[model samples]
Structure formats: structure tokens, C-alpha cells
Target: MAEKGRPRAFDRAAALRRAMVTFWELGYEGTKLTDLTAAMGINSASLYNTFGSKERLYREAVALYDRTAGSATNRALRGAPTARAAVEAMLRGNVDTFADPETPSGCMIVLSATNCSHQNRKVAEHLAEWRRTSVAELEKRLERAVEEGELEPGTDVAAIAAFYATILHGLSIEARDGVPLERLRSTVDHAVALWDSLVRQPAGRG
Candidate 1:
């Protein structure tokens, strides 16, 4: 073990990026220590020394994903001119990322840690919180769109957000199953088509 300023054998950030892709392609529990060490191009000792543990490394990898591959949806929600446009941009942007051959086929947060067993409950809960936060963010953006006169007053934004979130999650599964980019983009178009009627529906109408 070396002290601070002692150069490491491998690039830490680069290794983490590789870990993120591995977790994205294979769920958290499915990725073994050997898998990470191999992907990161580091040995077991380096992994444990640098990242503390596999769980800690996974958390960091997810954070990196949030800042990198997953940033586009947030940007769309903030940057688009209208609620419809924002939702469309968000979905389409994510679809493109999912379909990118250079990276894993699905979302890190959604596909990772799903269906964790009792012993892995905490891992499942962690991803659930991330998903709930994403839905909340969508609700907030839709509420803002209401204030901006983009969506009709009293629109049920919670339900709308949930609906779009489901579509977003489903698209990840589709991409993971090898759906073509063009077809996934078409799914986005089909999902956004409901925006008009959804906005017009009376609030709290179930």
C-alpha cells in the first residue's frame, strides 16, 4: 500500500467507468468480483483497496452513470420549450442512449438490482429510490409546464409522469432485448402521442 501522491498502477476513474458499463450490462448481483476486476483491468487487491468493497464500487458506478449516460433526460426536462416537447425529448434521448452499440443496451438504474432477494433488499431499495426520484423530477417539471401554460391547468401530472416513466423503463427492457434503434425511436413517438389527450383530461379523474 502506498501513501497519498503515490501513483497507482491503473487509472481509477477509467476503471470505474468500465465497472459502470459492466453493471449496466449485467445486474449488480450478477456481476462477480472477477468480472469487475477483469473489466477494470485491475486485480482484486487494487479493487478492494481503491473502492472499499464491491457494493461501494457499484454505488459509485451508478453515480457516474447518473452524471454521464443518464444526464440527457434531465436536460430535456429542463431545456425543452413545452411539456410535450420535454417528454418527447426525454424519451427519445434515452432511447438513443439505450440503443447505442458502444455502450450497454439498457439503463443502469432500472435494469440493475431489480428483483433482489431478501439478503439483497438494500440493493433493490437503493435503485427504487433512484427511480422514485426520477418520477418526482418529472412531476416537478410537468408542474412547471402548467405554470408556463404549456400543460392545461389542473392536469394530473403525477399520473402522467408515472406513465412516461413506465414507458421509459419498458424501453430499457426493449433495448436490452436487442430492439433496433429506429424501432425504439418509433416507440417513443407512439408514447408521446398520448400527451395531448393526457394533458386535456380533467385533473384527479383517475
Candidate 2:
């Protein structure tokens, strides 16, 4: 029998990061196989053997993003002392992240599969599900805020979460379209200020 091919030696973690950045910049369908190989500093055969397939690699890359960007988002929501403060921090933090000089603009999840061919429809659906998860998390946080009396007892927490989610996703698109960081920050400030009108602070409180 013929001898089996030998496994290639490489840093898997480092290679995955390079692939993640490629997908972050180019998206699922836009990212070419050659681009992944070039950025990863590996041959095509090596890449396929190591990553199994492009779709699988994309999923892994998104998971990496969840650990980094998604974790930071959750922190911004949960770390603050109040619901409004948490959302303010989350939105403001998104502005900073999308505008950071060190990485591609916009979000990987939002930009990665905005539009894809039918063959890649699954990828787009996968990203949409991730967005839904985010919306659900925000809804839960807002619901808790209602229970804690930070928001009006009759507040429609789900609707509030959807409103913020829409704004956050719009910010991602604007970042990708070259909207300036300062402008985005101004928008975030305005959005946060809306909380004053929405929340039901205790009597005699600001």
C-alpha cells in the first residue's frame, strides 16, 4: 500500500488568527481560497488538510471573534452598575471597536455574510442567527432592568432591545462604509441620552 501523507508542522492558533482577519476584512464569499493561504502563509493543500474546508474555517474564525469581540460586548453590558449605563457602555464601546486602527472596520458577523450567493446562503443564515442571539441577550438584560425598577414597569423591553440592536447593526454598516469615528461617537452619545426619556427613575431622582 502507498504511504500516507505526513502531517504538516505549523502553529494552528496563529494560522487561525490570520484566517480570521482575512474573513473579517473580506467576508465569507468575498474571501478567496488563495487569500486565506497567502495570509496564513501556508499552501492550499496544507490549508485544506489543516482546516478541513473553507466553511468550517469560517465558523472557527467566527468563534474566535465571539471569544474576543463578543466577550467584550457582554462585559460592557454586564459590568456597568445599571441597565442604562450598561447599554451606554456597550454602544460606546462598539464605536471604539469599529473605529480601532488596529483592525478592520465594522463587525465580522455583520459584514461577513451580508449578501452571499445561494451556495453560501447557509453562512448568511448562520450569521443572522448569531445576531438574533445578541438581540435576545439584550432583551434579557432590559427585562432584568424592568424588574429592578430602572425602567418603567410597563416598558416594552423587547422593543427597546430591538431598537438598540438596529442602531448597533447600523453603526457596523456605517463603519464599513467609511463613516468617521467622531460622528459615530456623537450618535452613540445621542442614543444613550434617549435613556433618560425611556427609563423610570425613582421619584425625585435625575
Best by TM-score: 1
Q: Which lDDT value does model 2 have at 85?
A: 80
List lDDT for all candidates, in order.
Answer: 0.90, 0.85
Clashes of each: 0, 0
TM-score of each prediction: 0.93, 0.91
| CA error at residue 127 for candidate 2, angstroms | 0.1
* Candidate 2, superposed: residue stretches over 4 Å from native: 1-5, 200-206
Q: What lDDT is obtained when candidate 2 is compared to the true structure?
A: 0.85
lDDT, model 1, position 191: 92
lDDT (Cα, tens digit) per residue for candidate 2, span 54-146: 999999999998788645568877788888887888898887888887899998988899899998899999999989998898888988888
Q: What TM-score does candidate 2 get on C-alpha atoms?
A: 0.91
lDDT of 1 by residue, 1-206 (tens): 68987546889999999999999888999999999999999989889999999989999998999989988788888899887888999999999999898998889999989978898898889889999999999999999988988878889999999999999999999999999998999889899888888888867886
